[model samples]
Target: MTKLWQQRLQRQQRLMLRYLRLVFNEFFMIAVFILLGGAAYSYAGYIKTLTAPLWWSRPLVLILLLVLLTVGHFATLLQAADSLFLLPQESALKGYLKQAFSHSVPLPWVLLSFVCGFLVPFLEIGGGRSLISIGVLWLSVLILKLGQLWGQVVQLYLPTTQFRSQQVTFYGLSLLSLGLGLYSWPALGFVFSILTASISRWRLQQVQQQHLFQWQLALNQEASRMLQIYRFFNLFTDVPQLQGQIKRRRYLQPLLRWTTGRTTNPFLYLNWRGFLRGTEYSGLYLRLLVIGAIVLLFLQQVWLALVIALVFSYLIGFQLLPFYRSYWDYPQQRLYPQPASRRQQAFLKFLTPLFVGIWLVFSLAAYQLWLAPFGWVIILGVGVFNVAFLKLYVPNWLKRHEN
Candidate 1:
């Protein structure tokens, strides 16, 4: 079981590394750097503008810290096959789970440290805490995270009835500990965190003694967690492991009818159907669109808003390009009466409205931020980029990769 855990971890790591390389390609890396640079610059400017902790600073920081504490889960790495294959070894599963939880700890801890470092200024300058107190506060949250992880470990062996109660206890402890840490003495929070972690450890031991491993529950949780990771990766590149759910968005049938002209072009009709019904393409489109719109809405600067709009617009079209050949593997598609050129033509036609719709949403956000002239500029600028991407970049890309 131990070796099995190690092998699984290594395989998962290698797969993630492979996707990470593709996800962070040259252009995407440049975009990420630009985004980080802009964010840092904006953060510094906003921090400088703060005279005192605004009225909402304490509660806001507390809520954010609480949220951070709630994030992350115990990764068992147990698979469906494990339920049967490893049944004999179930008694030793505690050791394997311990290893899994330990492995999961470092990433979230590193993330927590970075976030705390980022919020340090706000804690000190805004909430009027001493540097040492802020350090104590971080330590407190760190301990609370351990408790949270232990609680998750306990959850795996619990029945649903017990699980709900455990969840209530977990949240209650988290809230009180962090609230004390932020509002009262930092040491009080630290003390409560230690107690919380200790209690959670006791709870895990108790649960292990009283209950058997819940195989179905454990496997289901692992699958759900992995699916989320795959969904994020799916945004950057196709993830075969990610199984998208098909949604019958009946209300969207009208839009499909108008776009495909009732199967005038079978390829176009198929693309439209897949985009609307399959979660993969439509989910990606909506995620980018909403995220881009939110970012643009928040940004007061015209240049920043324009950059965001153009970046998002390009991303949507670029990602959707894969849909052009989505049906090629179907041997029946090769026998379509339509010429090969029509596929490309239909793809562009399918993408045209998508691009236009995304641009319009972004333009509206920019308009709300800075009205009239700037909004018109954003609209025109994004429209031109969309046209250039479709006319210049996409064709060359498809041609270069042509079968």
Candidate 2:
């Protein structure tokens, strides 16, 4: 029974479900979905911004959005090399490569389907709309997936340029038709998806008749090398030491002056280096600049701005942990003499600039309301907590473990 259960657990269907859950964990991806969906809902209200007037804007955003979706879809699949290469045999490679996440052809079609489906609902949600429109949107996705698999199978069997071109042509048409459906005839387009699926199936049958099934091993080293290159690029952007010098980062200049000609803590030095040298950390200040602008834009109300300001300060205070180990080589003799406490004043120092930015944003936001006075007092208290009092207080700081 246990062995049987284990087999079931390892089944492809179960794994696909697991992959779906993992994909949802991506905050940016989820945000993309919600933003697109929400944007569609709010688009009618935002029609004035369109350059081509009202009638043209609806189709324009649909087309642009479809393009974005298709591009994003292909990009996402390319990044999923791990999921694509799970099979061990070289002969079975063709089949595995042609599944739900395949990129070469299917992604564009899928993107189109999703964009069209989303647009259709918003563009034609009422007034005697055929139920087929909603149903056909889903049908189109199934067909696209089928078409992708068929194309891959054909590529494997025929192994010719002509077959590949056919796949590309089909994929392009799927996307174009989806866009058209979104603009005018969603119901007919949905049904058309089913027809597309049948054509894709027929194409697959033709390929199967002509070619033999064979598997190829996924190229592991190629994937690894590609990842390494990406990691190197990430170091330039994600790591702090590689950032270009910035004039606006003059606030950090004092650290260099204070440390010159004097012995300093290497850890402290590394932290400062990361703060100064890293684009991401420096980005915090830039974000602070933007947040103030956004708060005023979104919630012209005074209290909202004050709250956002207070929260922003706290967030900056808390997010400094990642910068603790950015630059420097450790010497054998170097060791921590004092225990690091979570409640240590070190945290407050890192948070001060963020808090200050928040205060400025708050002051600007609530310049007129009586709430400005209350917010000012709170800001003062937060400053004392972050600077004066926290400097003297020691809390539960986590010391590094000796491996």
Candidate 3:
């Protein structure tokens, strides 16, 4: 059983390493360092200005800590076939899960500790926490995280409805304990942590008596985690493993109709519908637009806001190029009456309005920042440039690369 677990772990690690290499390209690594530096500088500046904490500080921190501790699902590395092929090894599966949890718990604690330690200065300067108190709080968070991890394992043994209820109960108790711990009732928090740990153990024992392993549940959980990773990676590069996720999104149907309305060109229709159906493509565009708008709304510097907006516009245009090529995979698309020029036109037509809409959003945010005239010109100019670039330059560039 131990050997089996080790083999699975090594396989997962290899897969992770391959994806990690793809994720940390040189350009991405550089951008990450730049962003991290900017963040650290901003945080230091903000912390120095904090003479004292606001009333909401403790509760906000407590909530954030609770969320960090409670938010993740446990990864048991169990596959769907395990239920059938390894049914006889059910007892060993328990040991495997024990090992999994043992491996998983330390990383979150270490990360949480670093984050808490970093915020220690802020807690001291702003929230008036002593060193000893902070230490106690950190220890309490670690303990609660352990209980939460155990709770996640216990949940796999439960039916769907019961699992959800138990999850909610655990999160609520976690919040209460963290809140009490931070709000002058440290003893109560310790007691709650002990209680949660005890209850989790009791629940585990009870579930073990059934000698049942929920392989399907574990498989789904693991698959969901992988899909999330793939979705993020899909933003930067084509993730062939990614499966398109669609939502009916009845509310957006009208907009979809308006966009694709009675188009004689099949290429335009197919591309528009594909964008609407594929969550990855549409979600990426919307997320970048929102992020750009948020940066424009908050950052007092107009030039910085404009730069971010243009960068996001370029990203949106570039990313959507894949959608243009999506139809190429189907030989039927080749037989369509639409000419290649019309296909390119279709892509431009679909993307132009979307970029313009994003620009309008950013421009509105910029207007609030008192840069309306400059924002309008910058956004409009970029919007036009993006459309033209996507239509003319990108196709030839992609063809060259393909050749």
Q: Which candidate number would show the highest TM-score if scored against the true structure?
A: 1
The model with the greater TM-score, 2 or 3, is: 3
Residue by residue across 19-80, what tens digits does model 2's lDDT show?
Answer: 44543442324433443444554465444343332455455654564345334221112223
**For model 1, where is the 10-residue window of minimal lDDT?**
25-34
Q: List per-candidate RMSD values in Å.
A: 2.2, 9.1, 3.9
Q: Return the TM-score for each candidate structure.
A: 0.93, 0.50, 0.81
lDDT of 1 at 176: 84
Regions more than 4 Å wrong, model 2: 1-53, 68-88, 94-121, 125-168, 195-266, 276-316, 325-329, 332-348, 354-403
Off by over 4 Å in 1: 262-264, 329-336, 368-377
Task: Order the candidate numbers by lDDT, best to worst.
Answer: 1, 3, 2
Number of backbone clashes in candidate 3: 0
Q: Deviation in angstroms for 103 in model 1?
A: 0.5
The lDDT leader among the candidates is: 1
Clashing pairs for model 3 are none
Q: Model 3 misses residue 216 by how many Å?
A: 3.0
lDDT of 1: 0.82
Encode model 3's per-residue lDDT on 63-100: one tens digit a residue: 78977885555777777787788888777777888888
